[model samples]
Target: MLQKMSSVQPFQFEPEHEISEDENIEDVQYQINQNEDDRKVYEVRVGQNGWCLCGYCLPMLTGKESVCCKELQFFAVAVPDIPCITAHTSFEAVCLNRDVLWAALVSLHDRESADLSYRYASYRQFTWWMHVIRIRNIYSEPDGIYAGFEDVDIDYTEIDQAWRDW
Candidate 1:
């Protein structure tokens, strides 16, 4: 069994200016309106993967504009705290500011392949690989991901034997 707590408590007063009931009502209404407006504004949350719709594009998507740009950037520049490495890809290296992460991601997605003529598949493959590498690097740690690859040992005899067995 539990005892019921009393709802009433003794009030202590100190010297203070009194606010009128109407003034209090207005203040409360103002706070409520402000909160409502805040709710209407959309905010970007870090770590959530999605399109980086600019203010103008967002409004247009909602039928505010008859037509909107079909293309949008995907790669956001890496932030200082969130370090990136790009050695594996053709992109030598790229560092991002905290504000540019989203923009960078968008840019990567929107970037067009340079080999549009398709003279050689290798060219397209290389370009695509580089793009992917850049994206991967953006998510990698600052120290880098391939730090231990150089230390790996490879034996041609072992490889030949494994292939013969197969």
Candidate 2:
């Protein structure tokens, strides 16, 4: 269990019609919605292997007069703690910041690629103790999912040399 954050709420997935692992996952239709301010709650349907849910696309940059040029599918997944190298696929095991994690999965469009294309970092996340961390990349490999992060301590953020090096 995790302590509640200021604006985020923690939730668990309890399927109304729980099914066994041997059963088809498509049959398990369950969605857990949280408050509008709470983006942590999410929906997860059990699959044959475990969690095979794909993420959704980012908010499209609509209209001809849109501020941004292109609509990018940017997404991220936050966890209660750093995940083990081997347990990447089993995100639920470690606990997930559902909405963001789901968004990240949706961006992949059902592909299993680990490389991300966008250059500029769109989001920043903190660890369990609230240490600021810069999300470098979140991608999937043959083994499972991985989140690359850079610790942004005072030295890194304050020192000019450290900033350039990082």
Clashes of each: 14, 3
TM-score of each: 0.15, 0.15
Clashing pairs in 2: 55-105, 55-106, 56-106
Tens digit per residue, CA lDDT, model 1, 114-153: 5533433444466565665664554466767544212113
Q: Compared with the true structure, what per-residue lDDT tens digits does model 2 show for residues 84-141?
A: 3224444443346586676555433422344332211233332422432222122226
lDDT scores for all predictions? 0.36, 0.33
Name the top lDDT candidate: 1
